[model samples]
Target: MKLYWSSRSPFVRKVMVFAHECGLAERIVCVRTVVAMTKPNVDLLPVNPTGKIPTLLLDDGSALYDSAVICEYLDSLHGGPRLFPESGPARWTALRRHALGNNLTDNLMLWRNETLRPQPQQSPEILAAFELKVRNAVAALEHEAAALAADPVSIGHVAIACALGYIDFRFAALDWRTGHDRIARWYETFARRPSMVLTAHVDQ
Candidate 1:
């Protein structure tokens, strides 16, 4: 399998973390690619109309898209403990947390993009809305921080970690750690995992 990869993409990092956790990392080859919101990757258009990185090209020539689908597909290939919990309350809880984390990530990315636009072109209303979403979501996560590390690893955990990581990388000025002591501690321990250490973001 070939993966359209990027060091700076949290979504791509999530897929790679899943692969490594499944012990299937060696079977795939990473093809570094870059894509931006306003600027599309023309070469990637034929394969994925969205021109998104983290697109997985399987051996049979089928392509999988976006982080959520790709992670679920990769989980199916592994027989060990699943990244997505199976049916039951555990499943719903994981899904709920994953939704929260993923949405937070989406808003963070949107906020970052808004901030990058030339001052005159940026929409203050849009930026404020996204920033509010991020703050509220992080507060919810901080409130439930104790439970975050209690269960076995799940895709939800992966999602949360990546969301937090992106904030650390791109919005250090936000100082998310303030007053979110429990989550801060939880993140410190979680970030030590081999997958995270290997995938840590470095500015390009």
Candidate 2:
């Protein structure tokens, strides 16, 4: 398998982390590519119509993408330490947390993009709405994450870790760590994991 990878994409990092965690890292090859939403690489269109990072090309030339699906596929290669739990409310909880974390990431990205626009072209209303979503989502995660502090290595946990790291990467000025002490503590320990340490983000 070959991964159309990028060092700066948190989504790509998520898949790579899962593969390493599941011991499938050696089986996959990384092929670096750059895609910009504002001006996507046309060459990558065939690989992924959406021109997204972390697209996985299989031996048969089949392609799969979007980090969540790639991570789930990698998990299947190993016998059930399942990053996504099977059966019961645990599955729902993990899925919910994953969705929320993804939303947090999306909102943060939106906020960053808004900031990048020229002052005259930027939409203050859109920026404020996205920022509010970021705050609310972080607060919600902090509250729920505190309850799941005992076992903090599920899929949802991974999503939360990536979301927090992305904020540091692009929204450092937001200083989300101020009142969310529990989440901050959780991330401090989570970021120390081998997977995270190995894939720590460095500016391109």
Per-prediction TM-score, please? 0.97, 0.95
Candidate 2 minimal-lDDT segment of 10 residues: 145-154
TM-score of 2: 0.95
Off by over 4 Å in 2: none
In order, candidate lDDTs are: 0.88, 0.83
Query: Where in model 1 is the C-alpha error above 4 Å?
Result: none
After TM-score superposition, what is the CA distance of residue 117 in candidate 1 from its true location, in Å?
A: 0.8
Local distance difference test, candidate 2: 0.83
Pairs that collide in candidate 1 are: none
lDDT of 1 by residue, 1-204 (tens): 999988898888888877888878888898988789999999888888899988999999989998899989989998899989989988988888888888888899889889999999999899889888888888898976888879888888888999999999999999999989999999999899988988888666
Q: In angstroms, give how far residue 89 of model 2 lies from its true place.
A: 0.7
Candidate 2, 64-173: lDDT as tens digits: 98888888888788975888988688888888888887778878777877888899999989988998889888888778757668763678887888889988888888
- For model 1 the TM-score comes to 0.97
Deviation in angstroms for 97 in model 2? Answer: 1.0
Look at candidate 1 and tell me the lDDT of residue 163: 91
In angstroms, how far off is 91's CA in candidate 1? 0.6
Residue pairs with backbone atoms closer than 3 Å in model 2 (clashes): none
